[model samples]
Target: MERILREPLETYSTQKTQKFVGNPLANKLRGEYQRLLEEILPDRNRYLVVGSPGKGNWASCPWIAILDSLITDTAQSGYYPVLIFKEDMTGVYLSLNQGVTRVKEYYKRNAKNVLRVIAQDYRAKIEIDNEDLTEIDLASRNNNAKLYEAGNIIAKYYPADNLPTTTELIQDVRRFLNLYEELIFNDTQIDETKNLTALEKKQYRLHFRIERNSNIANKVKQHKGYKCEGCKFTFSSMYGSLGKEFIEAHHLIPISTLNLGNVQVNIETDFAVLCSNCHSMIHRLDDPSNLELLQKIIKDNLT
Candidate 1:
């Protein structure tokens, strides 16, 4: 684990970025490092362990992540625990961070603000014993670096000079993995059905649906631009930079009505991209899918 974390920090930037992927170090991160983590990952079957030197071009700060199957198998979208090297390679962070890609698609130029808001929300709600890490410095001004800095929920740092023993690293990883699973289980199965009347109950029922499937949302946005399908209003028109590419995906088939099992939502047909105002108003109707009725109400209400 130390070697996996150290080699990239020590050698990644020294090597040219374009050819870095073919390098042995990159191969080890992409292949061998994941196998070592596979051996240690809890309920190992539930995770798709992966590491990245970069996608097409080499990353300035490379990472090896333990991604959960329920949230996402890729580092591109869901939150996951990852060991990412700093830009300067002086240290690395064991960080619970988010995937910036989907956020970028949803918010376009305003993703940084959205990511920061989410990080703040998570920090406020979730409690980690001694791992109440606040901020991370990837030490670069790269776009991904900036996004990662905002996306970081919590982190533990290890300096390059003082890398821990493989066993210690393994222990830390396993403990963090357990915490990761706890976050997933808590978030994935939100049953308000089970009655709870405690102070913590409010926190338990806290609905911060942290990018559960922002990809689907992105696809909906892609199919229907940021304009409100119900009102033909675009957020960016009024709010400019703050509202660029902003819209919510409203389910044409109400989630409560649909069978959770074997139900597939087609991005092109099953969802409507509505501004938040229209999104809320659509639910007032008996059939939320009836955009025609929603439009008529708006037209009639105009004075």
Candidate 2:
């Protein structure tokens, strides 16, 4: 999982812009954040949009985007995404503290080599301008100062007591974000294709006549007095419509073996009611007549 970078609320520049330009950047950010949230959250499930309601000073939009992205990304990756929102001061502090702790724990578990790889990956993207030396240095210092101040404020609320180191935190975040990307883009397609192929095979092999099979199974159960001829496993309607243990009807001659002219006769003679295990074992052989071979093997194994 790659860690997503958390943009400071000031990044929206809403406070400065709201006074000067009259352009509602904060409200716009909030709306976009909510829309992104709707895309991620599960359908027909209630979720609380937790924040200081109507407090538009520090945009809560970034936090919402992070939560939505995390949830959707995790789900898309075939993993359950659990998002806990902090509505109050206590919850916010606790969650931040927990996040910090988790990040550290994650780093501790991973190897030093892995950490180095992660740092390299992150460092590669960091851009530093050297064109205007004095101005660039000043800008860099200011940015660092801002970041430090922001970190302090976050720590004030969260209180990073026994929290993970900065290095660990960075690594964890990188891993989380990476995983999210993989799930959202790569793994999702592979999973969908795999599922579709499996469904098609199932449909093709079983002919997907579920109702017909169920009816036939029921009739076979009644005909066989609800007893497996091979294993004597008895089933009744109390357990299911088919039986308590329900026998499977196996084709002595496979459906695939049917000729055009003999289709009707083939369907009629193709089935036998056997226990589930027995039915499976019957199909283990290349040909149904090779049940004799299975019987021999079983007798030999038993002896």
Candidate 3:
């Protein structure tokens, strides 16, 4: 797997001890900083800045403002810029690719310097040590690098100079943001329940089990009024508003384990509901008969 580059401040907590300047001066400084960043960093691809407010300080607010201004200015200059403000380093970085060239140019110009910082801090470098350099080369050649390489190809094939106007840049950024938001937030899990076909969706709903593995596991704690028949452990989706904790439905007989005649059976009746722990235990045994053993264990432990 290709290793991701990490920033210096990412690992160690750097003290941003600079006193908050007055609003006007702070704005001026922010503009200058952003301009310098534009000069040093690539104009392509969006930027993600991980910032902290730091012990009763409001510096992050100004920092975010600076980022917003930078993105706005880049948009006006006919370049797409997506600025993501991460509250901490642990969260997944959110970024939107505005225009092809914008991201390509950004990475091409900034990757080395960025990698240098990452290397200095992490004491590591991105090296292709794979035995199959040919495979790696072929992957790179085939545009398999997804975000980075694909953007470069698009930039090379269709330069930003062809973009023409600020309006076009804004429109491009907006469209990219919309698609990105949909993929990240709305298209996840049960939200996708609506998009599935009638049969597929019915199966999904019926067999939808909220295991500890589920993305919305935290939300499922509230709906545990229904106890798992296998383990006798109660479950609910009452934690968050999403109500994810309810009974998790699972296939008692694996889809693959089904007999030829039962292949066409309804999924709802074919599945069994189990609590999170019981569901895990069921899968842990890997044998269908283990469900009975799991039930016995649960009965012995609880009683």
What TM-score do all the candidates reach, one by one?
A: 0.63, 0.27, 0.26
Q: Of models 1 and 3, which has the larger lDDT?
A: 1
Off by over 4 Å in 3: 1-226, 237-245, 254-256, 259-265
Worst 10-residue lDDT window, candidate 2: 131-140
For residue 73, give model 1's deviation from the true position in Å. 2.1
Give stretches of model 1 more than 4 Å off.
188-193, 196-303
All models: lDDT? Answer: 0.75, 0.34, 0.34
Residues 238-300, model 1: lDDT tens digits: 999999999998767643445422335677877888888997788666566788899898888
Top-lDDT candidate index: 1
- Per-residue lDDT of 248 in model 3: 70
Comparison by TM-score, 1 against 3, better one: 1
**What is the C-alpha lDDT profile of model 2 across 105-126, one tens digit per residue?**
4554343334334333433333
TM-score of 2: 0.27
